[model samples]
Target: MDSRDWGRFLLPYEQAVEELKVKFKTLRTEFKSRDEYTPIEFVTGRIKRISSILEKAKRLNVPMDKLETGIEDIAGIRIMCQFVQDIHRLSALIRARKDMVVVYEKDYITNNKESGYRSYHIIIEYPVQTSLGLKPVLAEIQMRTLAMNFWATIEHSLNYKFKEHLPSDIKVRLQNAAEAAYQLDQEMASIRDEIISAQQHFEDKTHLVSRVLNGIQDLYYYHRIREAAQFQLKFNELWETEDMWQLKELSQELQEALQRAKRSNS
Candidate 1:
């Protein structure tokens, strides 16, 4: 296809990728807004290059005229998670969505590739509106843990550098490296609960500290300079102790002080 034809053909696929990325990212934000543990850590999307499309189509024996139905990954979305389990959770959520139809799934995590590549691949048919009409575009969503993604990225680069023919020694090393990455994922999963607890504690303390500081600032805005100074001192003392209870008490004290200051000023 000519450049113009290629651009026109890929436009709907690009739109599908962008929309899927936004939808998955919004899931992460919505989960956090509810103070819940989100399966998705981050999302990324891309459209296959023109050269790549041609190469794959040639390899798959797909006619240029039949590229739309023959190419499943013209548009791709990648979602990364902190734990392996999160990959499954995210995939299940995607399967339940109405905007897209799930075509198939490849569970590479359980049945890893010989090259040691591990990820969950979900093929979906997404509807994108064009000037002509609504177009159904096939897109692939790859879900993996952070470690798996890191390993896969390096492996991809190496494969490209070697033109899919790495030296035997380097291939051995890459396999070993993949195993190490998988081990890291397993270790992290084992302590996932503990890690999550610590993270939640930090988040809670951060919000509490913010509320206390805002209260002090409100007091200063009310012309209660003395009260604000006192609040600052108390916060400093509690912060140094690193005691959550003391910080909580300080936050309450500042909130009540701010209310009193407002009443007195009125």
Candidate 2:
């Protein structure tokens, strides 16, 4: 395809990647705000480069007209998780989503590749609205733990450098590294509950502090300077002591104070 045609073709894929990234990131934020243990650590996405797409199409004997349907990963989303089990959780979440429909899935984690590559790949059909109409695009979502991603990143660089014909010694080393990364993920899973508990505690405290501050701001806006200052001082004390219970109490009190101030003004 010419440069102009390539740009036109890639525009929708680019939009799909960006929109999916935002959706997944928003999911993380929602979980954090609710003080819930989220399996997803982060999300990233990209559109395959034109050159890379062409190379793959040529290798697979895909016609130019069939590129859109043939290239399942024209738009790719990578969801990184904290634990191996989290990968399954994220996949389930994706399956439950209404905006995208899972066309198929490959369980590479359960059945590792010969190269020792491990990840959960899901192909989904995502509908995007355009000036013409709603366009259903095929996108790939890969879920992996942090360790898996790290190992995969290095291996990908080497593969590119060697053009998929790595030296035998390097290939063995990469396989060993992949095994090590899997072991690391397993070790982390052993203490997953403890890690999740600590994270939830931190998120709860953050949410409480945020609510208290917002209430204090509302107090100040309503000409309740004295009450706002008093609550601010209390928040500082509780925050310094890391007293979540007292902070929760203070948040409730501030909310009440703000309501009373509003009522009095009315």
Q: Give the TM-score of candidate 2.
A: 0.88
Q: What is the C-alpha RMSD of each candidate to the true structure, in Å?
A: 1.5, 2.3
lDDT (10s digit) by residue, model 2, range 64-151: 9999899999999999999988899888899999999999999999899989899999999999888889999999999999988998
Q: Over the full model, what C-alpha lDDT does candidate 2 score relative to the true structure?
A: 0.91
Across residues 3-96, which tens digit of lDDT does each residue of candidate 1 receive? 8988899999999998999999999999989989889899999999999999999999999999999999999999999999888788889889
Off by over 4 Å in 2: 223-226
The 0-to-1 C-alpha lDDT of every candidate, in the order given, reads 0.91, 0.91
